[model samples]
Target: MTVPAAIQSTFDDLGTPLADVTFVVLDLETTGGSATECQITEVGAVKVRGGQQLGEFQTLVNPGEPIPAFISVLTGITNPMVATAPHIGSVMPAFLEFIGDAVLVAHNARFDITFLKVNCERLQLPWPGNVVLDTVHLARQLVTRDEAPNHKLSSLARVFSTRVTPDHRALHDAQATVDVLHGLIERVGNLGVHTLEELRSYTSRITPDQRRKRFLADSLPSAPGVYVFKDEHGEPLYIGTSIDIKRRVRNYFTASEQRTRMAEMVRLATSVTPIVCHTTLEAQVRELRLIAEHKPRYNRRSRHPERAMWLKLTAEVFPRLSIVRTVRDDGATYAGPFTSRSVAEQAVAAVHEVVPLRQCTGRLSSKGTGSACVLAEMGRCGAPCDGRQSPDDYAEIARRVARALDGDGHQVIDALGDRLRALAADQRFEDAAVVRDRMLALVRAAARAQRLTPLATSPEIIAAARTPAGGWEFTCVRYGRFAGATVCPPRSDPRGFIAALRESAEHVERPEAPVPAATHEETEKILRWMEQPGVRIVDIDGVWVCPVGGAAGAQESLDDTMTDRGDAVDFDDSTISRRRPGLRAI
Candidate 1:
């Protein structure tokens, strides 16, 4: 689909040109190093544009506290100098007026900016949201240590041979920084950094090879799509998706793209291939599919969907939880596409903590004879391997486990909560923490499965969400797969778009139970889009609902637990409200 001219211009536009930009080089003398404890004694800034001096701002602030002896000696701003001067509250307004909307430039800017921000808060004044530029950062990128030992204002002043030398005074230092800024801009301009946005994103870490490869992005389309960077032999080196293909690919040559691996890939890259899409969702899904198919060396994610692990309750006389790589059509309950085996084990432990499913891995029979393991001895298992527990009784335990994994996690969660309380009451806090972690991991997995399983199994689903551009973005899902997507213009008839979308949508065969129709990541992306705030169900061919008793409820209490850990598959499960059957708006 052709992109609207308005949308293309919005995403493809770059920032202000450097030659047309205004800058306010600033400096401050403070009473102490820490912004929280320190007070600004003097403020100095010079406003310049296109290499011409526009104006200057200078003021001494009465800190309302005695200036330290060392600070007075250093900046030569004794207590008497600021004793008659206005407080920060009075000086801030005039200084702010002088700078206007110019980009703020300072040497070691964090030090100067932090003090100003803190003073702004203390004085209860609104600080202008101006773009800030750090001369020190720019110097570090442009001037190597071999050129100057450090990027300090005095050192940089010497290296650039500025007419104004930096002294302890604020105004002199500010004047010196202004000259240093102009020098750094001139040096970086040689390497094609000629825009305010490019200068803002500049870093010395970007390699020479990357800068030389800027032409690679010149051929990409200026629209929402996927772009593949291919090597000379026609193998994909990297694959990515973006709203503006040309702009996004162009960033690879700039300092904004910091990944070392990607820099290497760009150096090796021969050509870029663009696959523009009609909608952002389509672009994202296509990127995932391409990444999985090609397994690009520089694309770190979504390349190996087959490597995902799942916790399967084995189909045996005695069902036990086991972590496996593949999901199948076999008649057995399944609980995840966990990111790792260790996380899957935590979920298993959570289930075992509440229900007495056999923990032993050995095969069991109703009339079997063997010694009961320590787990059975401690009452954690039913000792089914030794025929001590009848198949019917063990079957009841397995059914509870199935129910827990299948969305009814109340039994499991409630039992664990009780155990947790009991442990805490006994002052076994560390043990309670272990139980808490397992419960959280289990709830996370169950909630994920319960949330997506229904949507994945549905025959057909049509939905629309309000886009930022005031148009409605529509999607057609057949089984679990994203079949088609289109955006209805802000004032157009959505019904026509929906009808056309369904007619042209790809055909998807129904997938068997316990196996998702699409990859776990793909279904997750669709679920997230569907659950977003303004999504409305336009139509449906089958029921789309999660179990009322699902772990989704407990998931709220456990959601925060997944933040710190990398092993658990983290997706938002906080808002998976149970939906009613058929034609409904959500």
Candidate 2:
């Protein structure tokens, strides 16, 4: 059995949520201080899953040496008690088998784990390489210093109301730790920490400034909305959104929100203002808009809508597709607000490969003619400027371009599909991947454009999504932008409630002509919500339907493009302390 360098296990990968993970909570009663000076006297462990005890292991180990009088008094494990007990060499292998492959947890885990590792080495026994967790650190993170007084097992046991109490004994201490671990896990759940990798890397070291700003979120609404953290002079420092605005804002002061720069921003934050919304969709839209408008220094994403490039057909007698930074009201066929200019270009190039459109960037007049470019010379373009093609002939070519870029984008998809196949057949997987990515971006953008293209003059629509909490969330969208939104409590007749919600909802106005990338993104978000199976439509002043064959394959392409995920979490040291500086074990 050859263990090649790259042929390793993938189970260590980062995102196994806490609830799904098995935990082995263990405790050791040792003879003395360090592993070099001490010997294990007893071992106790409880195997747990989702807060339920699956099994337990308990054993007494003979040190094969005299037990000190103080140790005998502390543990109540005298020479007579351990004289009949098996030695550690025999007990160690049994303990290892009992733990299995689950994550190992214990209070002050380093002290206990160190002894086990050293003993395993001396006994020539294989150690189960399980990731370790210290409940003392977990207590420090979940319980405030004043609440616990100290992160000792005893203090945590009292604070969390442990099922059992520790009294210088192995099994009792292990039982207490099991309860503490379960409680801390539930606390971290509120901070969006559902994954085991997240728990392992969790850090709660908020700067003094973040601690002081805790008062700012005290008055924030618990309902859905956007939140802005402002500086002393009233400048926006950071912006965020949540269904529970107060909970989301408060999480910034906890260990789970450990983005280093975020702590610094919170330190400078003077106030927090929440924009309460009727639904999660509205909250998301408002958050994107505020981040774009404020361009907060502390905010990294959703700030620059203008930077998103779109490949749009020009509104002219001789229309040629051009990559533009702005999405405007001018009547033109558009392909994408692609992630980058290169991607937009790839989409445009993909279009040219199938539908021959004029490749010249110049704005040509109906009457004037210019020298033909290389593409026209190569017969790849219509060559309207060279008089090789008449106005009507070029107009026909432009119409093909419009239909290909606008409708279901069958031509564009087919073109990219052909190129991808050619590249893959040639063993150019990298090239094929590039084409696949272009196709994905094209599909996403075309999906957006197709939704708006046919219904450019579509009427207003009111729809509702059944929230997870049994409430109903409603949205009013007109011409692809949100007009109004509302959330209603659970009701017997959803239609009547939605109608009333639509009537009283505050109108979320939008500019009619020019649309920003943020607006497009928000519109797509609303459409996605409306398309969900359980969501119901209450009213329609106009029309809103998934365009035939539009974005139908977009979801599939998204799945294909994002199929590969990064491997599980790896840490530099066994202790979470070394994983993050300024963070200490309890």
Candidate 3:
């Protein structure tokens, strides 16, 4: 079967060819070996691609300190020689611009890269997250010890009979390292290491087992989607998502895939299944759903959103807070879907500190008599179990706790603040820190709930975010569930597309209050995407508002170090409509 020209082009261009990749072979001279306490004296680099030298950058940097006598004698770069040279701070930006996102190659790369990184941090400049290649490691992998006694640049320079000789000087060493790099590439080229990705990940050649499974990626499409790797029995071994399904699956069979478990999975795999989607968000959501459903052995994350813990106020006459695994429609106030029981317990402790609620585990009926625990004796509990506090009186205390959990956490914040202050005044700083942590945990949980509740209750919300390619990515959300996602190209009318979307979108059932339409993690993912910078709410139904004086205010203060309160409720989706009047209606 003949593949179409467009499809064939995508398949052919799986990765950047090694010949096309620009490499900056760099060398640095520093005052000392330790990057932390040293200063760079000189920098040199040679940029090349397709075995042709593009440019060379060499600079003598003023060390701002006296060069050691032995070092000055070694490289001949004296303190007097660098006295008029540019400082490292003045030279770094230009050097960074010179490298320009190219892969960095060096002999003993860690030593050279470390000095550059430490200096970049000292100058408060952003270090480019570049892919660094160590010729030492490469030579050790490719060059046999029989050919050279040691895998040093000088040794390899002789092994390859390079044009440039390695001296102690920076530029000469960098040039020599560049030639060594070409020699290693030539050696690996016969082993089918053709791409930059393969070269970067090439420790040795891909194992024969992994090489055998390369055909698994052949039939997959080059588009945004999820791919499943299944074993001989057809059960899923691993599941993953990517924008380019074919290219990403192909990576699993290459030297770039370093994970041991994945290498094993690929060896045991029988077939690859692809589920294509229209947008990246849809692909992500589908991946999460598939992983949760199949619980693939090789997949580690997003498989158990059900394991999340929540703090629920029990629906009883004498209500008490209980940590729960799931949210239900029990008419009880809920605080979190916290990541762990310990964190949920912290939020529980924060609540107990603020409210005088019963603490006993035994179910206490209004008519039954149960003994008061030690907590009541310490005045921490209402002791309703012993009839010291009436059900009516205990109900009032429960109301205050419920109010705090339902986003009005002003009372909880104030009480914790007073306790925190009292502990600090008494010089019990450790105890004060404990109080501060508990308060922050509770506030963070409450603040998260407040943010999600509006989305949960809303009937339908149409949102769009501008893509980098002058298009817009639209998401249809209903009751906090990601119902559908689509992209509108630049200069196109989104109203008709949105109208079609609303008609064809999945109909999600409105969940009971406090129980989000989707799992807490999934809803939070949607919320995060919705909150990104360029997102605009195109249309919405139902009241989407947060409490004015909610836990959001407390969360803000906690984030800003127990001071500076900001309004927690910024639920104004109308602002987006007012700004983008053209994309307002469906």
Clashing pairs in 2: 13-568, 14-568, 14-569, 204-255
Model 2, global lDDT: 0.73
Query: Residue pairs in steric clash, candidate 3?
Result: none
Per-candidate Cα lDDT values, in order, are 0.83, 0.73, 0.83
Q: How much does candidate 1 score in TM-score?
A: 0.80
Where's the lowest-lDDT run of ten residues in candidate 2? 572-581
- Please provide TM-scores, in order, for all candidate models, with all chains considered together: 0.80, 0.64, 0.73
Model 3 gets an lDDT of 0.83
Winner by lDDT: 1
Q: What C-alpha root-mean-square deviation, in Å, does candidate 1 show against the real structure?
A: 5.2
* Candidate 2 global Cα RMSD: 15.3
lDDT of 2 by residue, 1-586 (tens): 9986885423432247677789999999888988988899999999998777899999888988888999989888888889989999889888888888899999999999999999999998877889999988877777987786898888988988987888878999999999889889887776656677657756667544555466676667667888999999999999888888887777786566879898888888889988988777888888887888889998887787668677788888888889987767789766655656766776676667666788777887676568888887677887778677788887877776676566555655666678888999999998777666556555656665655542244456676667787887777776666667766677566667667766775554444333421355566566566656666666666544444655545534444445444321221110111111111111
Compared with the true structure, what per-residue lDDT tens digits does model 1 show for residues 296-359?
Answer: 9888878888877888888877788999988777888888778767778888988888888888
- Per-residue lDDT tens digits for candidate 3, residues 1-586, read 9986763454154657988889999999888788997789999999999999999999999998998988888788998889999999999999999999999999999999989888889999999999899999889888898999999878999999988888878999999998899989988787767777667777664675676577788778888899999998999999999999998998887767889899888889999999999888888888888898999999988788888888888889988889998788888889876877887888889888768887766688796488888988898887888788888888888988888888576877899999999999999999987887788778777777787887888989999888778988889999988899888899999878888889889999988877678877678777777776667788899666778878877675556553344422322111111111222333
Measured by TM-score, the strongest candidate is 1
Q: 2 or 3: which has the higher TM-score?
A: 3
Off by over 4 Å in 1: 1-130, 144-149, 166-175, 314-318, 359-387, 560-586
Which consecutive 10 residues in model 3 have the weakest lDDT in total?
A: 572-581
Ranking by TM-score: 1, 3, 2
Better of 2 and 3 by lDDT: 3
